[model samples]
Target: MKKLLILILLLPLLFVGRQVYSDDCDTSSVSNLNESQVKEMIGKCQKNWEMIVNAKKPHEESLRQMEKQLAAFQARLNTIASDLKQKEIKINEGDALLGKQEEILAHRVRQFYIKSFYNTPLLLIFSENKSNVEDVVRVLAYQQATTNDDKKTIIKIALYIKNLEDKKKQLETEKNQLSSLQTNVSEQAGKVKKLLTEANAYQVKLEGQISQLSARQEQLLAEKYAGSNYPMSVGETEPSRPVDDRTIDPGFRPAFDFFTFGYPHRVGMSQFGAFGRAKAGQNAETILKAYYNNVRIEKRDNLMGNINVNGYGSKSFEDEYLKGIGEVPSIWAEKGGYEALKVQAIAARSYAVSYTNNGQGSICTTQECQVYIGHNKGGDWERAVNDTRGVVIVSNDTNEVIKAWYASTAGGYTRTSADVWGRSTPFTKRLADLDGAGKAYEGPSYGDSPWFYVAWGSRSEYGNSAWLKSEEVADITNALMLYKADGGTLIHLSQPDKSNGDTWSSDRVKEELRNRGKNPYNSVSDVDTSSWRNGNGITSTVIIHGDAGDNTFDGGDYKYVFNIRAPANVHLKTALYNVEKK
Candidate 1:
């Protein structure tokens, strides 16, 4: 019995020992793997960062060389244009001069013919037959004068005609030569333009790379010194742990956010397959200035709220902006992407879009459709993303919400001079809160604007065509409830009507929304829209007024008011309550 008891105790001890040993081995393996991964990431990041840095120096030098070449070429082209203009003018003058010479030659030739053939021999014969010698001599003198005049006229006409014809031929030859030279110079200009375009594109790419490297450098410095300050909790998946200095690891590899949240430089159609725009030889300073300036503008306009404006200087922004604008659009168009812009808007539009169209989780933080994991310390690449907000709208299939969009922050509205032909939608208008303070719905519920009085049910015409709060709810119930009581519009704006009515039909409204394709819920909302969305996490709501005909509202006699969500107003609201658990 004593031995049995002892054996039991010993067996338990043996099991415990084995468990500890196994745990230690597993830990060792895990640590070793983590250390190796960190080291590998660090090496790759460093290589890429260094390569970008080295690339910039050469890129800048190449750009300077290209700029000089471009300047010379442009100057030569300008000279050619000027010379051609002058040559054309001279040709015109030459033609006029030739005409005058021809006229003079013709007159001289006619006079010569009359004197030489008809008068000269007759006068000579008459002089020989004269009775008085002195009189005969006088007659001979007259005849001699006529003959000499005729000979002189003939010689002058021949020389004049020959000289005029020669001059005309010479002018024609000179004109051809000038035109050929002009053509050659123009062709060279086109090539220089292409070069400038390539340089500009290369420069942009280099700068972006440099910005990324600098961000990485900053991240490394931060990691080496101060560890990431954000906290992690239990149940958190893939927690961001502090960097282990003992082990070398590259920080998180920055992801490519495919969403185009910010406005990038416009690229022309032809530049799609061309070489890098900055590679063509645009100056680094100019390209940098443009990128930063645009970043600044976007930041101010609430488009690129995530960009770090403090890192760049005004001069840099100006230089880059000019260079980018001056460059050919083809290169950037082909290679440029919206990754930077999407990252920037993450801060501006947090939790706006769920992670995926497919319902994997309740929410998504991935950069795909959700907010970007912006500028956390210990991450690589730090410059502000280029402006991309407000340029495009993010919408769902139903067109209920503008899930997200891009906009430009630059001033001097596009409608002014150069961008006159551009899209006329104003950033302020797009970004403004025009409906704030109940601007359109200030009147009493009964008298709210005639355009959208349908909410009150008083023979209102406006509410018939719009997407009601709920299809099941009658207009008298939901539509009127939204009126004077809440002072909110029941109807929303649709594409301008083809007919004379203020609102489109329900079908027409849906079709218009689909065609317009704006994500109405994308704007800052008081409450989340995902809760009410269908399985796809997308919903569209339309606010419209009455149709054109009066069958429903007495044939247009009842003018219904159009209720729209004020740009400044929040579409939804949220509240949180805390409870104590004992």
Candidate 2:
């Protein structure tokens, strides 16, 4: 199988036909750029892809927020529904009481007017005139109630009936108002869903583009390292999958490889659960314990001092290093509102230790490692750093500094490193990182950074899907075909488990065509939307479309079943996305 995969990867070189180059990334047309320049362009494109992928964090948060609001509105509507029913009952009772009171008080015609209101004579209507007046007197005479006081008593009853009618009207008005509020809430909720869906669609589009770009790079890489051993095995995990879910989404379609979940991640997943646990009276240790795996906090001597980060000479003291971490805002621990700052401090310190490039003695001050600013004294950073002095994260199994990678926030379900990085370590496990209210951080549209640490300066993961340009799929498809023609792997993909399935590392649709013994994707006729899965998470829909006029097999009515699973770095954001015809 491995031998077959290696041969399959080289299939592209056998058919170096006339290349139909992509307008965007036309590598074949360019000779001005040397190898370095090509690498530079690839790097820049990869960076852009990363940015696009991370862009989903805010939209996800927004959608999450809207969902929460929707839920609240639903709850309120339920309450209003109950109250409206009660109001109807009360109004009916009031109507019946008013009728009875008006009937009983008919004898006091003139007095009723004086008691209920002085000016509103129109509101007080009489059923009978002079003939009724005689009857009224007769009735009163029979009861021996001809006195003026008796007339006032009957008038009071009439006034009481008027008040009942007034109350019934007020209740009805309230019911109408509540009903209006319900309608508005429902509308807003609908709008939120629309916005969320659009945001999610945008995420999908971005992933698709990234997937295209990544596939371009992957093919280039395959061609670059076909004979040499570079770990593009038939079963190796995609390097960017689980670890880069924070960004670098590969349009991971489940249908691409029998609809399976690909490499997953805990890198960009949420810590809201841990925050929630802490807020709910769980101690910092407990919170950390839940999120971290097989880890023990150990007091250690300051790591080697004066590390070089980026271009600047970074001071090496553990506390000073903690002080310099610019990734998290300084105000977190100083404000004392969010104890998560301390946890961050410890994680930052541990990360610094892990990133200490033994060769260069330098770490990147950028997101490539963790952001670092020299001696940030803002907020209680000093205090927080001091309190957690000599603390370093150690893997219980390895007894070394663990890769204490953390992001601004996890969506909710902290991914396992195994899922994200394609290789799980004992310490890189998934945690029920929840919110203080015990809700999953990634649960719904609770978009606002409910975690206090994020409110200040921490960047949260954003977006649903990156938007794909109309021609990108075609361009990418064309590129993949070219790559295949150039003796690169064009058919069959390496599964996460080293198993083989029909998929190009870059273009699944093309792989599907090849599986049927056809030419690589010459053109994307249309993207099927019927198998669409709407979004809250990454995996969305199944795609069924017909692609005809290929090199080997010209056919139609092909159905792609996406594994409704979210493995990482594969390009199926939704089951089926839009396709551009060339």
Candidate 3:
């Protein structure tokens, strides 16, 4: 029993000692793993988790059984103890009765001895009468019979006391055995509990490893399908065009349509909106003033003669640099987009002057700065540049050149600098980009940009359809629920990679939702925008109806979680986007 107790006390220590020497699940190396390595590691981690769970089950059952056995042993030991106590009380009573009976028998034997030694010998010695002698013999016989009966009664009482003592001793022996058995069972239970604890800790460790592997996988996939992969610049010289989702047929019914209001950053001028305005007989100055609030078109002569251009050394700011900027299509000039070209020219020139701080800094030659091709883009583009010679957009409040940030499209509304970058600028304003009567000109007669409103995805890669399936949409909703619950650890909840065997199954996501105390949906039945940013055209609140129920979420959060958890090629281009269920 002592040895068993000592072993129980040492069980946890032994387990700990073994764990200290054993190989642990080291997730620190996850960052160094490539996609293939990460997938392999995830598989191994999952297998390890299964092994730990399997190992823990038997120990848990054994612990339960041991607990029940210990309870039974305790009850039996109590019963034995009670029996022994009652037998002891009876044995004590029997001992007192036997003592009294023995004393009484001794006194009676002494009185009979005195009477027989005196009276009976005198009757025999006198010999006067036979009857007298006969009477003395009868009295002696009766006394002997009475003494025998007393002696027999005392013997029976003593025998009964002995039987009670014997029974009490047997019960005590049984109680000792049960107590030892109970201690053994308790010790076994302790050992099993320790084993179970160790198993649980190992399971947690494996789970952590799996999470790290998944996060690394997600990072790799995100890098593969970065937003930079999309074309942010627009011009005839730009190589790629945005994929129009309308041209493709979504093979599945009840599609979840992700309608984006704009293509890129909606911070400044909308290039297509300018085209539409120019088509509607608006001049370059009018279009620029409409987008840039409180800004004037002014020709500045104090500008530097030469500005440093990245990868091409210094160049003339007006004569050489302005001619090569290819922001809008030259073909638009033939199609009544001349005023828009002039607007682009002036905006590009003003942006360069402010960006360089009057030639103090160098600028890159990408859309990140401005798309600049080396030679003069002789054509309508050159004509527009020359027509707006030395002209720059200057802020009225600051009396300085404005940055004049612009993008390809703005859906229907433009965002302010404060809305986009969290820093307010005097020149930038959130405008509806509509006509005088609150009518937009972006559909057929004007800008006609393909990206005005469309679903986003890699159509060439994923079945020529930019629309999402019902289950896929539900998965995105689940991702949002998890993000709302615990956004920190759910970084890897991206769409599963089937090729690499690192898929986060739909059932798995549902299980996680249940574990986090959030409802999971099987399919998204409908989705609609609940609120919009007043005058900004950005969706604010969205309500998603699923099989589980309807849930409301912040628009920005929905966009963020959707981008991260959606398929690699599919993503919302901006936060100011909407979702439609078809």
Candidate 4:
């Protein structure tokens, strides 16, 4: 937060950095001025304060969100910790039961051994029966008492002990799970608690700054306005409606798709790259340039509109929208700390701004827009948001805000906006990524090259052990058939005519393929795997022969190829994939 506390960028003037307001305003109150000047000054102060307050709205909401999440996590942690204790107790009890059963079994075995060994005929004869009557009688009695029932009792005790041991092992495993869950929940709560304290302190600092300026605001406004005559327009930019404004969807960029979809920055695992650089002592801006192409970090003007916050129509800042977003994994912010999260905050801010082009809908709460579930106020995320407040990534080409689309995975190359969205965006075209050799499977983080080949199935998430089987060929065939489906059916959905250059997975493929009556692929040999970007690995294109015949389907440029879907359990991993025999 020291980054935010430092007013280096915010010092020279009021309202915005590097921007002269429609009218220049004094940074301090009580700077002597004329009557007209005073009025303008007061107006400026009030307006700037309003904007600042508006900006603070999101941060406040973010804090609220964080509090809620922390509370929930705390509750969860408590439950898990309690369960862990219970499981431990159960295991201990089971141990005690097994030990007692073991003792009883040992005692029974000793009794049976004594009864049979000492009473043997040879031993009895050598001892002279009457002389050793006491020992003989003891042995004879034990031997007589050893019945079929005694043997069954020993067997039963052993089995009972075995069952107790198994139960104990099961309880131990459960205890471990509870312990892990507790750790996760506790970490979130602890971090959130620390952050909340920092956030409150920062807020207090801001309040003090605003209060000092407000105290002398009236006198300064009066003096400035009395001296000059400057016309002021109260309503230059009309307040816009959300529905009318351009809608922006700031959501999770899927694993491969984040990098593959057009955004100038490092698409997937861009955070990892940022973290690596940040830890290496590179500043935030240096890290930003590495992933995003043609990046310009600009101090954004205050333009946040009212948000349908938490279902109530509340006026909040744009940063709130970013902080509220749950689509982003907390791990990046937690592991990488400020630097890594700073990059995320910028990307998210830019992505949100691009969507806020219009005064559109109640804040989009789903990944359909960008998942905004909200967060606890004081955390690394809040720090990241505050550090780079109002800053956005702009494309140098058009000098416009770039539509920052990102995902979790990208084949070796980022997708061309034209191919994916059918738009001719210069900046978001297919670009090369640094995919290593073993890129087919998922890794610990997003920066790694994931399998783009639909056939190279590794549902690393599910268990990292699934592959495309021959039976799934039908699904792959169907995805390809969707492209071949009479051409006009789903093409309109893509709007080839409209090109703003945004590319993510086209759900239109799935939607179009739906309700189409198709038969399952009966054979793998009958399917074609010849057309490939990389034969044994990930590729941008792959041809799946819907039919064993020579007839070809019309593919845009790659020519008739099977379009594999990414959903692993249901669809193939990518377009380029081969089916393994079941």
Q: By TM-score, who's the top model here?
A: 3
Tens-place lDDT per residue, model 3, 491-577, is: 346566432344456678788889998889999888888465465578888888878998888888788667666765677777667
In model 1, which regions exceed 4 Å deviation? 1-32, 60-96, 116-582
Top lDDT prediction, candidate number: 3
lDDT of each: 0.28, 0.45, 0.77, 0.45
TM-score against native, each model: 0.24, 0.38, 0.60, 0.38
> Between 1 and 3, whose TM-score is larger?
3
Writing each residue's lDDT as its tens digit, candidate 1 over 1-582 gives 234224223421101111111111111222223212232333344444334334444434444544554455456556656665665666566666656666665666666566556445556577655555456456556666665676665566556656655665665565555455445534544554554455445445534443444445434323322322221111111122222211322122110000111111111110111111123332322222222211212222332212222222221221232112211211222234223223323322322321212122233233222222322311111222233323222222332222222212111010111121122222112111012342211122211211111111111131111112222111222222233223222232211222223433444433443445421121111111221122211112222222211112111111111212211110111010010111
Candidate 4 per-residue lDDT, tens place, 1-582, comes to 233223222322111221212233443544443222333354565555445445445544544554564455456556656765665666576667656766765676677677667567677667755657677677667655654456565566557656656665665565565455445534544554554455445445544544444445434333322322111110111111111001212121111111111112223223334444454455677655555567677876754654554453554555455566553344545444357567667766676666766235455655435556564444666777788887877888888776666543444344544444333464564434433553321222333222222222234443343333343444344445664664433222222122223311334444555556533343333433333344322233434443343333322312122221323322232233333321
Candidate 2: lDDT of 184?
A: 55
Q: Pairing residues by index, what is the TM-score of model 1?
A: 0.24
Candidate 2 local lDDT, 1-582, one digit each (tens): 234224323422111111211124334433344322344455444444344344444545554554564465456557656766765676576667656655555646545444435323343244346565556556545444534555565566556656655665665665565455446545654665655455455445544544454455445434432332211111111111222222333343321122211112235313333334434555556666667787888878746656666676656555455676665444333223255656666776777777773224677766557766555555565666777876878888988887787653453445565454333468766554445565553233332232211101111222232223223334344433443344233223222222234333445545654665656543444444322223222223323232443222111111111110111222331112322221
| Error at 106, model 4, angstroms | 99
